[model samples]
Target: MTAKYPNKEHVTYATFLSSNRREKVDGVEIGTQFTKVVVNHPLQENEELVRPMKHCKTIGDVHSEGTSIAWPSICIQKING
Candidate 1:
């Protein structure tokens, strides 16, 4: 998704299933779920946004082939888990 900043900066995201109960995909849930997204020591000049409360995306402004709750490729489209 192209962001409204600059001429045109497509702000893609790395989706993930962090404790969020999304639809059953093809992979199994692993490790610990994500809770808080820690910010740098000094706030950078970048916009940090979670896709949505339902389907949460990890970091914005990234470019990937998209993921799911199965693969857990860094994956969530459901509400609370």
Candidate 2:
């Protein structure tokens, strides 16, 4: 994604899945889940000094291939002395 400023300068962003949980994807009676995204800071021209601005992106903007859940097995074991 690219964002343009007043001067028409564009910024490129490379987003990744910093962290996530099952709850975010689906409400399975689990705890709340959050997704964190990081962007590559680029140099921007100002009056004199160049500063790196923080990029803000919504969670919905993220794209995923798919998701799967691994349920734990429940069984009883028998022991003999």
Candidate 3:
């Protein structure tokens, strides 16, 4: 299967579910149907890199209304490299 975020730096197991659909397997809900099957390539060590964003802080006076800041966006990278 193709990676979810192909342009991304890392490859993860969850990436396989990108273009998949929901289905029921043996009365249990599972992944998508077999649209196509592709051979899984051998994963290399340190083949992929994921640079995740860490903590972020805003410098301002807490009691000052105008000096405060809003919430920031967070990106968490799950590495399977």
lDDT of 1 by residue, 1-81 (tens): 223222234333223334445333333323343322222121222433333223433332222223332222232223254
Report the C-alpha lDDT of model 2 over 1-81, residue by residue, as the tens digit.
Answer: 223322323332333333333433233322223232333333332211111212212211221212222111111111244
Ranked by TM-score from best down, the candidates are 2, 1, 3
Candidate 2 weakest lDDT stretch, 10 residues: 69-78
The CA lDDT at 44 in model 2 is: 30
Which model, 2 or 3, shows the larger lDDT?
A: 2
The candidate that achieves the highest lDDT relative to the unseen native structure: 1
Q: Which is superior by TM-score, 1 or 3?
A: 1
- Residue 77 accuracy (lDDT) in model 3: 34
In model 2, which runs have C-alpha deviations exceeding 4 angstroms?
Answer: 4-9, 18-36, 43-81
Structural similarity to truth (TM-score) of each candidate: 0.18, 0.20, 0.17
The local distance difference test score of each candidate is 0.30, 0.25, 0.23
Candidate 2 has which clashing residue pairs, if any?
A: none
Q: Give the clash count for each candidate.
A: 4, 0, 0
Superposing all C-alpha atoms, what RMSD in Å does each candidate have to the true structure?
13.1, 19.5, 17.3
Model 3, which residues run further than 4 Å from truth? 1-4, 8-20, 24-39, 43-81
Worst lDDT run of 10 residues, candidate 1, spans 36-45
Q: Write the per-residue lDDT of candidate 3 for residues 1-81, one digit (tens) a residue.
A: 122223433221222222233433223333333221111232322232221112212111211222111211121133477
